[model samples]
Target chain A: MLPLRVKSMPADRKGIRVDLQLVADMIEPGTRVLDVGCGDGTLLDYLVHFRQVDGRGLELSPDGVHACISAGLPVIQGDADTDLKDYPDDAYDYVVLSQTLQAMYAPKAVLTHLLRIGRRAIISFPNFAYWRVRLYLFLWGRMPRNETLPYTWYETPNIHFCSILDFLELCREMGIVIERSHVLDSWGVPRMMGRSRFLANLFGVQAVFLLRKSG
Target chain B: MGVTERKSTGQAPTSLDGTGPIPGYHVRLGCDSPLRLDCGVELFDFPTAYQTYGRLNADKSNAVLVCHALTGDQFVADAHPVTGKPGWWEMMVGAGKVLDTDRFYVICANILGGCMGTIGPREVNPATGKAWGLSFPVITIADMVRAQAMLIDHLGIDRLFAVVGGSLGGMQVLEWAASYPQRLYTAIPIATALLHTAQNIAFHEVGRQAIMADPDWCGGDYLDQGKRPLRGLAVARMAAHITYLSESALHQKFGRKLQDRKAFTYGFDADFQVESYLRYQGSIFVDRFDANSYLYITRAMDYFDLVESHGGPTKLFRNTPVRFCIVSFTGDWLYPTPENQKIVHALNAVAANVSFAEVVSDKGHDAFLLDEPDFHRVLTGFISGAWERRQGHAAAQG
Candidate 1:
């Protein structure tokens, strides 16, 4: 019998982005996970190998889906906006949506679906009210273009960009409970904000929140 | 493990033409037992031609059946005995290709109602010892799958590792998952739909009409009359061939360039290279294919409606243990991405383990058979993953 190539975990944990590492920390080991917008499956791969989660992915780009599948990851080419409703209720223990909520056509509907399909949902997104973005827009009176939000106004895919406070307000409106949250600074380092929404919304470049639907 | 005694060693009776013995493993099934088909007909003692690559492992768990498309035979990884050309899927089924014959056992069979050394319209009816021709019972996709199941049972394989194919072959893969879910570990259906669309049936109708309209057809009994309807079969092939390719692929390959001359001859003398290419494709197809078999196979495809026979996607695949991987090509208008996504959505509804990839390619529906790197990578990944998972299960059980 030929020796099959078995994939091993990367030796360096720091190789993953800080926000994704925080998101991974929120998931329980051996849980069923579905990662929407799983580009190249880096986080999902880590979850599967390190956390032993039964992970699947839904990616929009053909290249991302191809890369994931070629690496022996289960992934499908599908849009989160339309394909999420097909999944049955509570089909997975954790459904992770990272850095893609702002680009969605309907973030509220998608959040509703995420909660409906999974027992818990871990979501991350670039904060639109970060200090640098506010400063750039206030200083130039133009749309901000930075490392996180790189695209210009005419070509940006992030149409529904929101701040940390905006996401918390939406979660409150949807009757979703934020079990845990983390705010990240511009260097992809986590900040030690303890439930300070104003400070997090004003200074945090990105945010990760673990959420569940309230009864 | 001792069930290896049933292996056939690729030997069987001569073909219909008696040109020479069929060049692969042949088995005469239903000698004492008859296969009752969906069309209310019993076929007995029929010959099934197939080819196998690699050795079935000791536990008989490494077999991956490769279902062939329309006009494709069991010659999967080797040279075709008739065409003397490379196998249709030579790009994917070789020693180290995507299918990886080195690590997996691959089997491909000429489908029932096919002309490639299989029991079809071209074969003789035992009762009258005459060419069955149009009298052969109309077989459906389920019937084809049933025949394949019998073949698997004959080989003594309790379950296959996977069953994979594209287009018509993909239809067979789906039927396998639906009809005999427990017999295969995983199923990969590429560039296919749950049912034949109305437009699909219309295109098939055109091909069938073209063949029947040929003066030499002689009511499909041309074989018995020692006459071959070459022109009609060629025309049918020409028309059907166009549906397998996209307009952009046609434009890129041939466009409006003159065949050999610098300019048009002011007459219908194969002016455009596309026309000449289609003519050549038509001419070559008739040499190796049987026209009556074409009609029977197309009818089988037209009658294929899994939802009608089984139920809705959820109902059809409810609680199925078979892992599914559905693939589609961007340029495949015949079985577009939406049609393929219907399978994924259906699987998702049941929360069944399924993966899907719409490979970015301009190769059209035939992309599955072409050398598309992304498609190959996807297949390689899915198959290896399925194998690893299966091994993991076996280890846990042991």
Candidate 2:
């Protein structure tokens, strides 16, 4: 085993992905957070170190769990599809699903569980209705393979891909309250597009939303 | 000469092997500071045998205690003094392994109720001047942790870097976290559960009964009678051994394979390879382990339930400053994954810092001791990260 040196330098939030940075910004210090599909737990680590949040993570793969644990992040090896039911209601202040909503087997059920398990939920996913994706799918009768959606039709883990408007409609039907939303370009740069929901759906390559239970 | 002189001390009517101090690596507690067992009895002059590796840095912040499982001794990273076999946990406690003796002070002790140069049923009771035997107070997992805490106090370290263990050893680790959370920075409880299940208790009962039913057992005074219940202990070991292995593993290793002969013996002899292997395991085990020790230890485990002591399972870590890594094996029915998840769920309820890993392996309950790279990888990461967190905490305090 490689000997790991404890590096005490403060987390450099500037180097984090733009969407993740935005999500991190919404979380309050000292609150409990659970990151679903927390790949290697970079966001959880950042939240713990910089935001002083009580952070936890859940990853489906053993390798990702090992990486997270090795870094001293609290992570459980579990699938979001079924493991969410085991968590107590309002167990966390914020439940995060960054860029992993599309890969879920039942996105709607998982979304409902996120709201049920946390006071607020943060979800980020590629928007299939972005101009480039729509044009690629419209021009070629194949699944779009672009900068934001890179995997091919057969090998992609994005089984339930949806547009930004589709997600809003889902929240509407499930009685979820969308407290805040953000948009990002294909390059992961923050975009000022959520001002007009329609234009954001048409132009934004990715969408992130902070949601809460309506009742 | 030493044995005869000590026998006449005339305090108790206990069996006397030898009176001149125990001959191996050990720590003796004096009568002035007796170990107060959970049973409300104060055990005096109790000796705890332990082995340590690596150097303890000046600040004494790098000490790591590795608790051994049932049938395991203090030979964590060295050759066993009795069997000449490599240490039980050499895979994860050596120089370059996850515990990494080169970087931390690693210590392993024969548990309080163990026979290997420790205060167990084989030890003479000073009060009665006799082999405690069946008279040795039944020890609980918490009692074992208390003894370890004394050892730690004796070592002069205020706090430990981490406490780690698997199976029965894992119980000790859990008890340490619950009873003395401030004494250790982190805990790694592998292939274990929050409590012993009814199924687990039933299995242990079968083994204990097997030992007690043996004629040569002499009603737990087999030592004074100059006899060992080899047959009964062997049978008990054989039965318990099956629980440590998975059905898939057993099938893959010895599925109806005949022993030495092409066909089964027409009589009541060991014909199958699995039977022969089990017989060999049982016969050799009796040579090193005492049947009475097995009874006491199994009883201790059967009585273990963290909820009973800490209120509820979820309340075990309430308001505690402990970081935990709980691991389980996919094929381990003895202490299955769901049981381990209960622990993780409890930790989560209290918002305690915890991680849970369900490793894929066919080695059953023994997987934690095997060469599963995923287990090692998880430990390596957990320990390194915990160390880093400790450093961060120290920096903040400064």
Candidate 3:
């Protein structure tokens, strides 16, 4: 049979968002990876092309699932909240969930499943305790809405919104090891807040963490 | 492998049996070795009518077997001989289409208990020299797959590139994956479930009862008795047709509007447009379908319980290497998204490589057959990807 031509890669290697690029950086080349809540498969395509990873995706929306599959990415139409448990233990080298943890009904349960399914879990989410968000809620006495958190209380999918400190405490309680971490400013650039959890939680607009099960 | 000899009896003269001129390719399989069916009956010297599109490459890895639905025939991308209409899945099977005959060798066969040329209740039984009718051994979905496996074997192809279908065809796809996992590289079961629900069986029962209640049915021997239970079969088709569509689709296609007249007719003479439409659908269906074949096929579907036969849902696909793409549509009430998802979950539990998509459609259970762009795109992407992966595996082995 004639060899079919593979699709050409996107010209821009740095086209993905900074947070996603950070998540991509943590993944080792040619390892099995699953991206939970993989909307449009931007991160997955990047990982497959650049990192040479065998990537799979789980997306909730029908539109998102179709879009991912249409781009030739293997994606399932499923909710991360309920679908993650179906994966076998350590099925992937890395499991990535970006910007979707706060919207989960049970963020802790999802995190547990993520860590169980992959050797390591990479998660990124907006920090509700960021100074600007805290100030906006303090000044207006209303649910803070910004570019990162772009919805009102009733309309928001971010039901279980949490601060960076809250997430760190939960990880500690669950006996999860924080392998590496990054605190991003509003522009999605990593801020230099080494060894200072208080300043990171107080100022970082978003946080990304690489975690693994405690020994 | 050498039990049955492969020979194509190309275009034999119209036989004395009630079935008309043979169409397309017909092969007489299991002549020396009979096919042992689920019902403990062995079928020998059975004929399988099939059609092929594109060309099988030298390595023969591009062959894709498309399983047709209950009423569908082997005419995957061509015009039907009897109906003169386009093939059922023409939208998804031609050049540049989702199945893309240009790149893939596509094959479809008339299923075991189907009326379109394949051996069914309408065919003559060699022992009795008459139509089998109700005497035809009760077959199941497994029986259908067993027959298809025979055809694939006779064609000199060991492993098919893919086996794809929707609805009952989808059930056959699942059966293929379960019973012959090593024979196919990828499986695409769209708008189907691992087993038939009680509601599904109930609907089939209604259609069966409608056919049996007809005075002209002659206890399933209508063919030999010089009588055709057209009305009974038409009613059965009409009732079964409703289940294949969504309530919203019905409403959208034919509301409370009257047929041919602005006002409703007091007498029961197909006044509503919906009534007339269904009546027309029923009337045309009997022209191409067989009453006894309908009964046997529906019974086969009703008896399909993968969990019962395969131990359990998750157990059915344990350690399978075949890639799966399970597709469901939002408006398909017959086999809803949740039912399809159960198959995904089962595959997931076994760590089988599977992709699933529930395409958004208001067209109901028939959405898989209709012109849904999203559905088309998903199929295109999946087939192309699976092809690429198959190539990758082949190259790696080399």
Docking quality (DockQ) for each candidate: 0.67, 0.59, 0.63
Q: Across residues B1-398, which tens digit of lDDT does each residue of candidate 2 receive? A: 00111212233222223333333455565445778888898886676777888989988999999999989988787776556678888888878888888899998878988887679998777788877899999999999999888878877888999999999989899999999999999999999988999999999999999999999999999888988899999999999999999999999999989999988679979999999999999988887788999999999999999978888755678876988999999989999999888788777677678898889999888899899998898889889888988988888897
Q: Return the candidate ranking by lDDT, descending.
A: 3, 1, 2
Candidate 1: residue pairs that collide: B10-B25
Please provide, for model 3 over A70-160, each residue's C-alpha lDDT reduced to its tens digit, 9 standing for 90 to 100: 7778889998888888888988899998888987889989999999999999998888899999999899998887766667678777788
Candidate 3 regions exceeding 4 Å error are: A1-13, A139-142, A191-193, B1-19
Per-residue lDDT of B186-220 in model 1, one digit per residue for the tens? Answer: 99999999899999999999999999999889999
Q: Lowest-scoring 10 consecutive residues by lDDT in candidate 3 chain A? A: A1-10
**Candidate 1: tens digits of C-alpha lDDT, residues A1-215:** 00101112222355776777888989999999999899889898899989999899998888888888877788888999999999999999999998889878999999999999999999988888999999999999999887777677787777898888888889888899988888887665686568678999988888889999997
Better of 2 and 3 by TM-score: 3
Between candidates 1 and 3, the DockQ winner: 1
iRMSD for every model: 0.9, 1.6, 1.1
Name the docking class for model 1: medium
- Residues B230-347, model 3: lDDT tens digits: 8988999899889889999999998888889978678999999999999999998988888898999999999998878998865788989898998999999999999999889888
Best by DockQ: 1
* Native-to-model Cα distance after best TM-score fit, residue B398 in candidate 2, in Å: 3.2
